[model samples]
Target: MSDPFTFQMLVNYLIIGAGLMALGTLGFLSRRNMIVMFLSAEMMLQGTALTLVAFGRYHGNWTGQIFTIVILTVAACEASIALALILILFNRKSSLDVTLWNEIREPGQPAIVEDPAEAEATEPVPGVESYPVLTPAGIEPEHQTWTVHRD
Candidate 1:
Protein backbone atom coordinates (compact mmCIF):
# COMPACT_ATOMS: atom_id res chain seq x y z
CA MET A 1 0.00 0.00 0.00
CA SER A 2 1.09 3.58 -0.67
CA ASP A 3 2.10 5.95 2.13
CA PRO A 4 -0.75 7.87 3.68
CA PHE A 5 -1.38 11.49 2.63
CA THR A 6 0.07 13.85 5.26
CA PHE A 7 -0.85 17.39 6.27
CA GLN A 8 2.47 18.67 4.91
CA MET A 9 1.77 17.11 1.55
CA LEU A 10 -1.68 18.65 1.44
CA VAL A 11 -0.27 22.08 2.28
CA ASN A 12 2.34 21.71 -0.43
CA TYR A 13 -0.28 20.76 -2.99
CA LEU A 14 -2.43 23.71 -1.98
CA ILE A 15 0.50 26.09 -2.33
CA ILE A 16 1.34 24.85 -5.81
CA GLY A 17 -2.30 25.04 -6.86
CA ALA A 18 -2.54 28.61 -5.55
CA GLY A 19 0.59 29.55 -7.47
CA LEU A 20 -0.85 28.17 -10.67
CA MET A 21 -4.07 30.06 -10.08
CA ALA A 22 -2.21 33.31 -9.47
CA LEU A 23 -0.08 32.94 -12.57
CA GLY A 24 -3.12 32.10 -14.66
CA THR A 25 -4.99 35.12 -13.33
CA LEU A 26 -2.05 37.41 -14.11
CA GLY A 27 -1.70 36.03 -17.63
CA PHE A 28 -5.40 36.33 -18.32
CA LEU A 29 -5.51 39.93 -17.12
CA SER A 30 -2.27 41.25 -18.62
CA ARG A 31 -2.18 39.56 -22.02
CA ARG A 32 -3.96 40.85 -25.13
CA ASN A 33 -3.77 37.71 -27.31
CA MET A 34 -6.98 35.67 -27.44
CA ILE A 35 -5.22 32.28 -27.53
CA VAL A 36 -2.99 33.23 -24.57
CA MET A 37 -6.05 34.36 -22.62
CA PHE A 38 -7.83 31.10 -23.40
CA LEU A 39 -4.82 29.10 -22.18
CA SER A 40 -4.68 31.20 -19.02
CA ALA A 41 -8.32 30.40 -18.30
CA GLU A 42 -7.55 26.71 -18.70
CA MET A 43 -4.62 27.06 -16.32
CA MET A 44 -6.89 28.58 -13.71
CA LEU A 45 -9.33 25.67 -14.09
CA GLN A 46 -6.48 23.16 -13.75
CA GLY A 47 -5.35 24.89 -10.55
CA THR A 48 -8.84 24.60 -9.09
CA ALA A 49 -8.98 20.92 -10.05
CA LEU A 50 -5.62 20.31 -8.43
CA THR A 51 -6.75 21.89 -5.18
CA LEU A 52 -9.95 19.82 -5.21
CA VAL A 53 -8.06 16.57 -5.76
CA ALA A 54 -5.61 17.40 -3.00
CA PHE A 55 -8.37 18.11 -0.50
CA GLY A 56 -10.29 14.97 -1.46
CA ARG A 57 -7.22 12.78 -1.06
CA TYR A 58 -6.33 14.35 2.29
CA HIS A 59 -9.85 13.64 3.56
CA GLY A 60 -9.73 10.02 2.33
CA ASN A 61 -12.75 10.47 0.10
CA TRP A 62 -13.59 10.15 -3.64
CA THR A 63 -15.21 13.59 -3.77
CA GLY A 64 -12.15 15.51 -4.98
CA GLN A 65 -11.37 13.12 -7.82
CA ILE A 66 -14.99 13.05 -8.89
CA PHE A 67 -15.16 16.83 -8.88
CA THR A 68 -11.91 17.00 -10.86
CA ILE A 69 -13.40 14.63 -13.45
CA VAL A 70 -16.45 16.82 -13.74
CA ILE A 71 -14.25 19.88 -14.11
CA LEU A 72 -12.31 18.12 -16.87
CA THR A 73 -15.53 17.36 -18.76
CA VAL A 74 -16.60 20.97 -18.49
CA ALA A 75 -13.16 22.13 -19.63
CA ALA A 76 -13.32 19.86 -22.68
CA CYS A 77 -16.64 21.32 -23.72
CA GLU A 78 -15.34 24.83 -23.06
CA ALA A 79 -12.30 24.14 -25.24
CA SER A 80 -14.37 23.17 -28.26
CA ILE A 81 -16.70 26.15 -27.90
CA ALA A 82 -13.88 28.61 -27.20
CA LEU A 83 -11.88 27.38 -30.19
CA ALA A 84 -14.87 27.77 -32.50
CA LEU A 85 -15.49 31.28 -31.19
CA ILE A 86 -11.83 32.19 -31.62
CA LEU A 87 -11.86 30.93 -35.19
CA ILE A 88 -15.01 32.86 -36.03
CA LEU A 89 -13.68 36.03 -34.37
CA PHE A 90 -10.35 35.71 -36.17
CA ASN A 91 -12.09 35.25 -39.51
CA ARG A 92 -14.07 38.43 -38.95
CA LYS A 93 -11.28 40.60 -37.51
CA SER A 94 -8.15 39.08 -39.09
CA SER A 95 -6.45 39.47 -35.68
CA LEU A 96 -6.27 37.68 -32.33
CA ASP A 97 -5.82 40.86 -30.28
CA VAL A 98 -8.53 41.30 -27.63
CA THR A 99 -8.42 45.09 -27.88
CA LEU A 100 -10.01 44.82 -31.32
CA TRP A 101 -13.09 43.26 -29.72
CA ASN A 102 -14.35 46.35 -27.89
CA GLU A 103 -17.13 46.68 -30.41
CA ILE A 104 -18.81 43.60 -28.96
CA ARG A 105 -19.06 45.05 -25.47
CA GLU A 106 -22.44 45.76 -23.84
CA PRO A 107 -24.46 48.51 -25.48
CA GLY A 108 -24.30 50.81 -22.45
CA GLN A 109 -20.54 50.53 -22.12
CA PRO A 110 -18.28 53.06 -23.81
CA ALA A 111 -15.89 51.70 -26.43
CA ILE A 112 -12.20 51.73 -25.55
CA VAL A 113 -10.28 53.22 -28.45
CA GLU A 114 -6.55 53.78 -28.62
CA ASP A 115 -5.17 57.05 -29.94
CA PRO A 116 -3.63 56.91 -33.43
CA ALA A 117 -0.34 58.44 -32.24
CA GLU A 118 -0.12 56.07 -29.29
CA ALA A 119 -0.93 53.12 -31.54
CA GLU A 120 1.80 54.16 -33.95
CA ALA A 121 4.25 54.49 -31.07
CA THR A 122 3.40 51.00 -29.87
CA GLU A 123 3.98 49.49 -33.36
CA PRO A 124 6.99 47.22 -33.71
CA VAL A 125 10.14 48.62 -35.24
CA PRO A 126 11.18 47.37 -38.70
CA GLY A 127 14.32 45.19 -39.23
CA VAL A 128 13.94 43.83 -35.68
CA GLU A 129 11.66 40.94 -36.41
CA SER A 130 10.48 38.74 -33.55
CA TYR A 131 10.81 35.50 -35.56
CA PRO A 132 14.02 33.69 -36.39
CA VAL A 133 15.88 34.22 -39.69
CA LEU A 134 17.28 31.41 -41.85
CA THR A 135 20.51 31.70 -43.83
CA PRO A 136 20.81 30.49 -47.48
CA ALA A 137 22.43 27.05 -47.93
CA GLY A 138 24.62 25.78 -50.79
CA ILE A 139 25.73 27.61 -53.96
CA GLU A 140 23.57 28.79 -56.82
CA PRO A 141 24.00 26.85 -60.11
CA GLU A 142 24.96 28.73 -63.31
CA HIS A 143 22.30 28.71 -66.01
CA GLN A 144 23.00 28.51 -69.77
CA THR A 145 20.78 30.61 -72.07
CA TRP A 146 19.56 28.78 -75.19
CA THR A 147 18.37 30.69 -78.31
CA VAL A 148 15.44 29.30 -80.26
CA HIS A 149 15.09 30.02 -84.06
CA ARG A 150 11.72 29.85 -85.82
CA ASP A 151 11.33 29.50 -89.58
Candidate 2:
Protein backbone atom coordinates (compact mmCIF):
# COMPACT_ATOMS: atom_id res chain seq x y z
CA MET A 1 0.00 0.00 0.00
CA SER A 2 1.09 3.56 -0.78
CA ASP A 3 2.09 5.78 2.15
CA PRO A 4 -0.48 8.38 3.21
CA PHE A 5 2.03 11.16 3.87
CA THR A 6 3.70 13.05 1.06
CA PHE A 7 7.47 13.66 0.69
CA GLN A 8 6.85 17.30 1.57
CA MET A 9 5.45 16.29 4.93
CA LEU A 10 8.62 14.40 5.78
CA VAL A 11 10.69 17.38 4.81
CA ASN A 12 8.59 19.55 7.09
CA TYR A 13 9.14 17.20 9.98
CA LEU A 14 12.90 17.24 9.43
CA ILE A 15 12.91 21.03 9.26
CA ILE A 16 10.95 21.28 12.49
CA GLY A 17 13.35 18.92 14.21
CA ALA A 18 16.32 20.95 13.03
CA GLY A 19 14.70 24.10 14.34
CA LEU A 20 14.13 22.51 17.73
CA MET A 21 17.76 21.42 17.94
CA ALA A 22 18.95 24.89 17.04
CA LEU A 23 16.75 26.48 19.64
CA GLY A 24 17.97 24.03 22.25
CA THR A 25 21.61 24.74 21.38
CA LEU A 26 21.07 28.46 21.69
CA GLY A 27 19.30 28.00 25.01
CA PHE A 28 22.05 25.75 26.29
CA LEU A 29 24.70 28.30 25.37
CA SER A 30 22.84 31.22 26.95
CA ARG A 31 21.53 29.76 30.19
CA ARG A 32 23.65 29.25 33.34
CA ASN A 33 21.21 27.37 35.55
CA MET A 34 21.59 23.55 35.59
CA ILE A 35 17.82 23.05 35.34
CA VAL A 36 17.60 25.29 32.29
CA MET A 37 20.49 23.44 30.68
CA PHE A 38 18.74 20.13 31.25
CA LEU A 39 15.52 21.49 29.75
CA SER A 40 17.44 22.68 26.70
CA ALA A 41 18.99 19.24 26.34
CA GLU A 42 15.51 17.69 26.44
CA MET A 43 14.40 20.06 23.70
CA MET A 44 17.27 18.85 21.52
CA LEU A 45 16.26 15.26 22.24
CA GLN A 46 12.66 16.02 21.29
CA GLY A 47 13.89 17.40 18.01
CA THR A 48 15.87 14.24 17.38
CA ALA A 49 12.82 12.14 18.24
CA LEU A 50 10.73 14.04 15.69
CA THR A 51 13.26 13.49 12.96
CA LEU A 52 13.57 9.79 13.77
CA VAL A 53 9.80 9.34 13.70
CA ALA A 54 9.62 11.08 10.36
CA PHE A 55 12.34 8.83 8.91
CA GLY A 56 10.59 5.69 10.19
CA ARG A 57 7.32 6.83 8.65
CA TYR A 58 8.98 7.68 5.33
CA HIS A 59 10.72 4.31 5.14
CA GLY A 60 7.59 2.34 6.06
CA ASN A 61 9.47 0.65 8.92
CA TRP A 62 9.43 0.63 12.74
CA THR A 63 13.13 1.50 13.06
CA GLY A 64 12.57 5.21 13.64
CA GLN A 65 9.92 4.63 16.25
CA ILE A 66 12.05 2.11 18.03
CA PHE A 67 14.94 4.52 18.08
CA THR A 68 12.70 7.25 19.47
CA ILE A 69 11.58 4.96 22.27
CA VAL A 70 15.21 4.34 23.10
CA ILE A 71 15.89 8.04 23.03
CA LEU A 72 13.03 8.66 25.44
CA THR A 73 14.39 6.05 27.81
CA VAL A 74 17.84 7.58 27.63
CA ALA A 75 16.43 11.04 28.12
CA ALA A 76 14.62 9.91 31.25
CA CYS A 77 17.80 8.44 32.65
CA GLU A 78 19.70 11.61 31.77
CA ALA A 79 17.10 13.79 33.48
CA SER A 80 17.26 11.78 36.68
CA ILE A 81 21.04 12.00 36.77
CA ALA A 82 20.93 15.71 36.05
CA LEU A 83 18.42 16.27 38.84
CA ALA A 84 20.62 14.50 41.34
CA LEU A 85 23.69 16.45 40.22
CA ILE A 86 21.79 19.71 40.44
CA LEU A 87 20.58 18.90 43.92
CA ILE A 88 24.07 18.08 45.09
CA LEU A 89 25.52 21.25 43.56
CA PHE A 90 22.76 23.37 45.09
CA ASN A 91 23.31 21.83 48.51
CA ARG A 92 27.01 22.62 48.35
CA LYS A 93 26.58 26.29 47.57
CA SER A 94 22.98 26.91 48.62
CA SER A 95 22.51 28.70 45.31
CA LEU A 96 21.54 27.58 41.81
CA ASP A 97 23.79 30.12 40.15
CA VAL A 98 26.34 28.13 38.16
CA THR A 99 29.10 30.67 38.69
CA LEU A 100 29.49 29.34 42.21
CA TRP A 101 31.22 26.28 40.82
CA ASN A 102 33.80 28.14 38.76
CA GLU A 103 36.50 26.80 41.03
CA ILE A 104 36.03 23.34 39.49
CA ARG A 105 38.74 23.63 36.89
CA GLU A 106 42.19 22.35 36.02
CA PRO A 107 44.65 22.37 38.90
CA GLY A 108 46.90 25.09 37.52
CA GLN A 109 44.33 27.13 35.68
CA PRO A 110 43.21 30.48 37.00
CA ALA A 111 39.53 30.82 37.74
CA ILE A 112 37.35 32.45 35.10
CA VAL A 113 35.68 35.64 36.24
CA GLU A 114 33.03 37.68 34.52
CA ASP A 115 33.81 41.30 33.99
CA PRO A 116 32.06 43.50 36.50
CA ALA A 117 30.90 46.04 33.89
CA GLU A 118 29.35 43.35 31.73
CA ALA A 119 27.78 41.64 34.68
CA GLU A 120 26.23 44.92 35.78
CA ALA A 121 25.00 45.80 32.33
CA THR A 122 23.40 42.46 31.56
CA GLU A 123 20.27 42.35 33.66
CA PRO A 124 18.65 39.00 34.32
CA VAL A 125 15.78 37.92 32.08
CA PRO A 126 12.46 39.45 33.07
CA GLY A 127 10.60 37.50 35.78
CA VAL A 128 13.82 35.63 36.67
CA GLU A 129 14.48 36.54 40.26
CA SER A 130 17.27 35.37 42.53
CA TYR A 131 16.08 33.21 45.40
CA PRO A 132 15.62 35.09 48.62
CA VAL A 133 18.50 35.05 51.08
CA LEU A 134 17.86 33.96 54.63
CA THR A 135 18.46 36.74 57.12
CA PRO A 136 21.49 36.25 59.40
CA ALA A 137 20.63 35.76 63.05
CA GLY A 138 22.51 37.42 65.85
CA ILE A 139 25.87 36.27 67.17
CA GLU A 140 26.35 33.43 69.69
CA PRO A 141 24.87 34.13 73.12
CA GLU A 142 27.30 34.63 75.99
CA HIS A 143 26.99 32.34 79.06
CA GLN A 144 29.82 33.93 80.98
CA THR A 145 28.88 32.72 84.48
CA TRP A 146 27.61 29.33 85.75
CA THR A 147 26.83 30.11 89.37
CA VAL A 148 25.73 26.58 90.49
CA HIS A 149 28.82 26.09 92.72
CA ARG A 150 28.28 29.42 94.50
CA ASP A 151 24.57 28.79 94.89
In order, the Cα lDDT scores of the candidates are 0.88, 0.86
Residue 71, candidate 1: C-alpha displacement in angstroms: 0.8
Off by over 4 Å in 2: 1-3, 107-110, 115-151
lDDT of 1 by residue, 44-138 (tens): 99999999999999999999999999999999999999999999887777778888889889999988885646643555557667455789889
The C-alpha TM-scores of every prediction are 0.73, 0.73
What digit string (tens of lDDT, one per residue) describes model 2 on residues 44-64?
999999999999998889999
Checking candidate 1 for backbone clashes, the offending pairs are: none
User: What does the lDDT come to for candidate 1?
Assistant: 0.88
State how far residue 76 of model 1 sits from its true place (Å). Answer: 0.5
